[model samples]
Target: MYQYKNNILSIPARLLYQDWSLMSYDTYKKKCDRKQLIRTQQGKGLGNEAFLSYADLPHEIKSVCLDKIGRPEETVVINLLEPFIIPDSKASAFFSNHRTPEGRPLAEPKQRQKSINCWILNAVQLVFEDRGMTGKMFGKRKTRIWQNISEAVNKLDTNKWNHTLPGAAKRLKEKYENYLKEGYGIFIHKGEGNQNTAKIRGEVADFILSHYALPIKLTIPMVLAKYNLRRLEQNWPELAESGLYHWLYEPEQERIWTLARHGKQAWQNKFQHTLSRDKSNWFPNVYWAIDGTKLDWIHFDHTTGHKMASKLRINVLFDVYSEKIIGWSLSETEDHTDHFKAIKMAVKQAECRPYLLTYDNQSGHKMTRMQEFYNDLVALKGGCHHAHRAGAKNNPAEQLFNRFQQQVITKFWFSDGQGIRVKKEDHQPNTDFITAHKHHLKSKEELSPAWEMAVNQWNSGKHPHFEESRDEMYQHPMSLREQLSLQEIMQHLWVTESQKPITYKKEGLTLWLSHTQYQYEVYDGDGNIDIEFRRKYVGKKFIVRYDPDAMDVYIQLCELNAHQEKVFVAFAEPKRKHIDIPVLMQADDKMSWARDYAVRDIEYKRDKTAFEALIARSGYSPSAFIESQELNIKFKGSMPKKQQQKVDAEEDEVLLRM
Candidate 1:
């Protein structure tokens, strides 16, 4: 027996082997060789030649080798190579002599034989029995009972057993091959290990793809939920609280509301109501309403840098119903002359004589000269009725003034010289003034001039309001006058005059006479007719009337026809009252002696019988009930009859003589 320590073997069998010197020496030599082979096998250098040499060694050497190598290959090699020559006793001796240090016999050949027996047994068990001992049990039983167990142990090991002991080794080899083929049977295990990780990774990928990989068609709520969840997950509480979440929900509507609240209110108060034609109520040639307004007044001189100093007033007249401007004047001063010019323009522009001219109680409109003109017009039956009324309620023209101020005048600031108050002595240009002009030009001259130009351009140019020029709005004066025929224009020139009743005192015959200073004398059959006439006032009225043609007065009834024939008879004045005759006449025909003639007459006669009767009745003599008459009969030509006819010879001679 031997106990191995480190790389050396120790033996207690020296006394038992004292008489076997040669065997002991051979055993020592074989043991040294086996130790060499064991060293070689353990170091990964073993080969078939080393196994054969180990099996052929002597019993004593094999024992020594077994003790030295701690493995039994030499004895098996001896049994295989020299089986016929070696007796069973020597082989048995060889196997018994070999023992491990534990006192068990080192039976290298018998161990090999026993391992073969066990392998054979396991094979028989697998072949004959319903269930065989498992390959693991076979490996354990072979390792416990086998001698020189390297080959038998290798046959039972699945990897080494594949080469020997065909049936059991092949089955064991197949089992291990299938285990490797199924990836170490680890499919379900790997899946179980990674399941939670894959799920979390998939969710993260879905979030990233949803945000960045697709078009943004989601509603605001969806977007909010997505971002909120993400932010919550990301621990960004502050980001989640930003009102940007709500703002993105209604972006367009909120933007529009913001603009409406903050934008300019420039065009809010434009004119709302338009004048309707039905509201106009025009009287028939009676009322003449006149008014004027100042359009834009600037403190600065609009023409030159010279301060206009005074505001320019533009006077305009509205014909109320016509809505036409009858007169207009642009002037710096708001004096009576301005008023007079406006009125004169209106009068000349009126299509018919106005009955009453209504005007506001302006001081400039109440001039004495204007009043005198009104009285003269009344005297001429021109229907001069002047009414000075308050401007508050009755003035439609004042509304127009307000419109002008609101719409046009107040839109611009005037550069009128009223800038900064300075002493008159400092008014002259100096270095400071020059500096002001250079530096403060925007305040000084820019806006006023631009405003003036804009207004002028608006008036003269096409207007958006009327869609016409200011000049075109009221017809051009020349064109309007030219549109009327010559006769119609001449008719417009006729002046009206009224007649008062008058009585004459000559010869105690109460007569109505017209007084006249002599301008022309007509020769009647009784020589030059006197053209002088005297007027006498008989009650509240003139007692005489004048002859328009003879330029003298006769009894009111002693006027005549074209042939020196009497036309009217002198009448006696009534004791109770003197009667007055109503006269409406034109002054144009009496213009030659207009200043000298006290009255003018006009007659509309359509027939010769009326003319002849007036001529014959004019020759009556005056009595106390009537009156004496100094009559002058000078005939003015008569209007041509529309239908001329020739009478018979007798009638023709009477007409010619008459």
Candidate 2:
């Protein structure tokens, strides 16, 4: 405390020191005998009446007496204003007396101290405001927070400044920075609902959160712009009217930053490579690894038996530990139905569902149908990077494909790659393997028997490490059955599957999947359009795997963790089949019509040379030919759509008879 009654308080002349030579010698001798005083008694000597003027006061001591006449750091101003800025409940709790367990007020010293501190802070705030200091510099770095706090603490009855100034400044700096970063909410420990947010509160929060989850990335300005626009469109008034944008930017920095930096894939990879896996959890049926492989061996067209195609899809499922191929399906496309059939076959043969099913990031594996099967069978999942991730982390199916390719595919006929390579060397094209086997198989029923023979041979073979065959290894192990009822799991999880690539049109509110254009409209449980539930899902691609047999499938694009993630969220129906027979037939008919019209138009144009030859062959005289030549021109009301050639007078006279 600096004191001023009628005028500024005068300093005592004993506080001023000069004559350093004599003072230093005396201090050196009296160092151990007395205190090392900063100031020495001057010309006043022992006179108690001698008071020095303000000009005579030391600069360091003069600064303490005078309140700084400039703006202080915002944190210092904030600290000063806290007693008034805090809400009513907090103000009461901070200013009130200490409470007992029974809620009775106690006359404790701590309570009296807080009351004094609050009063002192309010007094300091008034002086700072009088000196033109205000809490407006939020962006400015708080450099003088400690100096202001220290000076204010000394004036108050606080022992906070007992430590060294440097140490006190350092601690104060950290505290102020933390307060700025975390917010004034730190002091009161404000919970979520209790905090004050004028701009980003209530519905504004919902709009910001919803927009931020869009698949496309955005900057804070863009998101804020959206917020402003939505408020304006919704006919809500601007938040601050002046500093709304800056106010929103300053407060929700950390939260907005998190949403901005994230991409669509971030959700899927959140815990990808972090968690550890235990291999001791493995068993015969504990984990069944399944994936689709485009088999090297080409398959013949079912009816022709000689029309071989590029490749056939092989959906294989095997016991991971036993290294046995349990079931496989050969199909033209790697579809959900093919995958379901393969897994069903494997489960039925084993008479139990595997506790876990490991799969690859493939179209068939990621399908909603497969996800449903996965949800029913097991919950545990993990994968690791290794030498050629396909063979190592993947199930035995990959290795089985390699072995099957070597023994069967190469023995009969080389694959496309080998065929080309071998043809270049030998100067001869390879014959089809199905050409030899076609005579042996007659129908789809026979095809299964052929595959069964191959599978039986594969299962009966001795294990590479053990004397027991793959079949023996699979049967001997007593693994715990997955708790789900087989019948219930199959009936509940099996959905009639249809899938296609659907593109989201943010503006059009339509999904362009295949050749069909489907709309995304919100529908209620009764399948009626719900006009109130309108949301715009921006640009992103989704595989709409739907139940093909269902009378109607509802599709809506939702957030990444949004419920029903494992199923088709943003939906697609058969916009048009990939190859619609009727549509193709109609297109072909139109093209044929165009070709016939072109031929008829060409035939209708008569040639002058042919007419002259016909007249010569008919034995018409030169007089008759000259008489037959006639000049005529006619005008039509409307011109044709195509450009007409204008006659060149000079060329027409030379080419045609006049």
Candidate 3:
């Protein structure tokens, strides 16, 4: 059926015509083999015998050969497409002799056997197809043919295949016949060696999951104990603790287990999918996040004359866009006062009010006073304020506070580890050492400066989204100014001394606030007592609002609107005291005194002029009445008593008419 010359196997024309129906080998070779359609081998002693490398033949031609020889095309295609290399024939021996550097077999025992089986199947198929032998050719003849094909496969591609084929002739024959009958499935091991023995029954698995996945956080051991008590009654098989653990802690069940055992809040904080907010377009003063956190450092308390029992609270107003600490205050307690100071500082420094303020529902923030300011500021800017639910995990201000604690407080030796959620086992401060060196503890005074330094350092740090530092980003000029005058902002921030209406007096609007007396009088923009304002508004009632720090400057006067809300009227300055001595008088004082004197002199002159005009309007003369009286006296001296009496009577009548 075939011939070999110079070790190149070739198919004879008669066999090709018998198997493939190629009428002329020369014509076929010229049209197909020469064109590389069928791989051809040149043999030195070839004549009428077509030199061919069976392994290198075209797949179609190999399929025809396999069909003629009664072998499946699948196995033939696999063998022809990736024919056995030279190393394959001795693969079993090479694998058995070779060992890893550690002196272990190159492949796992089972895997090695699988590779050998695969090779045995390929080699037997190659022998039948290449040697044109079949199972019908039995005993030594078939064995001899197998030996020849295996030797050739080993001599060809020595570097390509790294496998072993080791089996008796009988075993090889059995595998080959089985492979042809049942295809590739025969190689797949169906033994109990690789079976999953630890898999629990479906009902048992459901019971384990139902008990293990719960909010009470039962450990595997605890869950196992509970299952043990119940499994005996339910006729369940004994379970290994390790297997139970593996089943319960599978990666696929992690989310379900966490949610069930840790509760919704914990799951949300730790595992919920969250999206990042894009704040690239946000500008400073457009959004402000305010929150307070304890400083986590023990400091000396001057008021108590000893080391503080608690940490100081730090209230901060953070510009969300820039992440800048725009304003902050250190206090023994967090209250509306601290919030007021912080917000006031922020507004003052930014020269603008925030368009939106984000805060949590804390006692300090919920004060009617603070809430009103928040509402009024947003109202003025046509923006809105939002109050986050208390203890929310996603508050931006809380994240900022966390960063502050980590980046700032952790730098100090006295800082408490409580500020950080995750800390080294040995990170906590030594209380005994702190107590022994109590004098070294920082006082509120020292901490104040230190806190200020930390704030400056934070503001100087690089911003997350911008190339500049936090302060630089915040200080960058805004495209559109939301600038509010300091006074205007103060109107909202200042506390109301008394909501009850009080009448304005000459001495100004007087009220008792925080155990101190404050007197405010109407003053014009030029710092002069506004006499016209005083005349118009004096004795009228109004509500007073004053800045505690600026009590000497002015107070805001407001009147009740139809809605019973205080509507700002005007600014009333602290009442000015007159300078008794001229030498101590300022220019303004002298001017005020001169205006008062001038007004008095003008009033006196006007009153005298008004008297003369009144006499003329009466249509009577005082000189005429005096002349008549003198004439009557003369007549009494020269004439009779009756004539004198008549003259006196006529004079009296004229006087009465006047």
Give the best candidate by lDDT. Answer: 3
Listing every candidate in turn, what is its Cα RMSD in Å to the true structure after a full C-alpha superposition? 63.3, 30.5, 43.7
Once model 3 is optimally superposed onto the true structure by TM-score, how far is the C-alpha of residue 559 displaced, in angstroms?
A: 2.0
Comparing candidate 2 with candidate 3, which one achieves the higher lDDT?
3
Model 3 lDDT per residue over 538-631, tens place: 5577877766557787788888775668799998876655554666666986776665435323422433343334334432234544566577
Worst 10 residues of 1 by lDDT: 266-275
Question: Looking at model 3, which ten-residue stretch has the lowest summed lDDT?
Answer: 72-81
Q: What order do candidates take by lDDT, descending?
A: 3, 2, 1
What's the TM-score of every candidate structure? 0.22, 0.32, 0.39
Report the C-alpha lDDT of model 1 over 1-658, residue by residue, as the tens digit.
3332111232333322353353464564466466632321121255421122333334665675455556632222211111111122433344356433223563464444433323333343342233232322222354332222223334233432222332444443453344346521211222222222222223332232232212233443454455454545555432221233222222222222222222212101110111112112233424456665443434445467654343556666655443455665566556545555655566566543455566677665655544544443321354565555554677766765554444455444432221235455322224354445543334223444654454454345443357666546545442212132345433332211123333222212232212312221112233211112211111112323232222232223243344644344333222111112123223532342332222111111211232233233422111210111111112122223321122211221232244
* lDDT digits (tens) for residues 1-658 of candidate 2: 2222112234343333332122344443353144332222223356433333444444654664354322122112113333332223443465364333224463545444444433443443444464344332111235554455554444332353121212355554564455447532333322222222444554555444434433354554566565564465566544432233333333122223223335313321321111112233243426677777765544455657556554556788878767688877776667666666677677667765566676666665666556655666562333121122443644555666666655544443324333455445432234564556545423433345555666677778776789898878887756455444667544544443334444443222354332344454333454332212212222334444332223255543433332425443543322211122333445754554454334222321222233234333433323432332222123242324332222222222222242
Scored against the true structure, residue 311 in model 2 reaches a CA lDDT of: 52
Question: Candidate 3: which pairs clash?
Answer: 86-154, 86-157, 91-164, 92-164
- The Cα error of candidate 1 at residue 58, in Å, is 99
Which run of 10 residues does model 2 get worst, by summed lDDT? 267-276
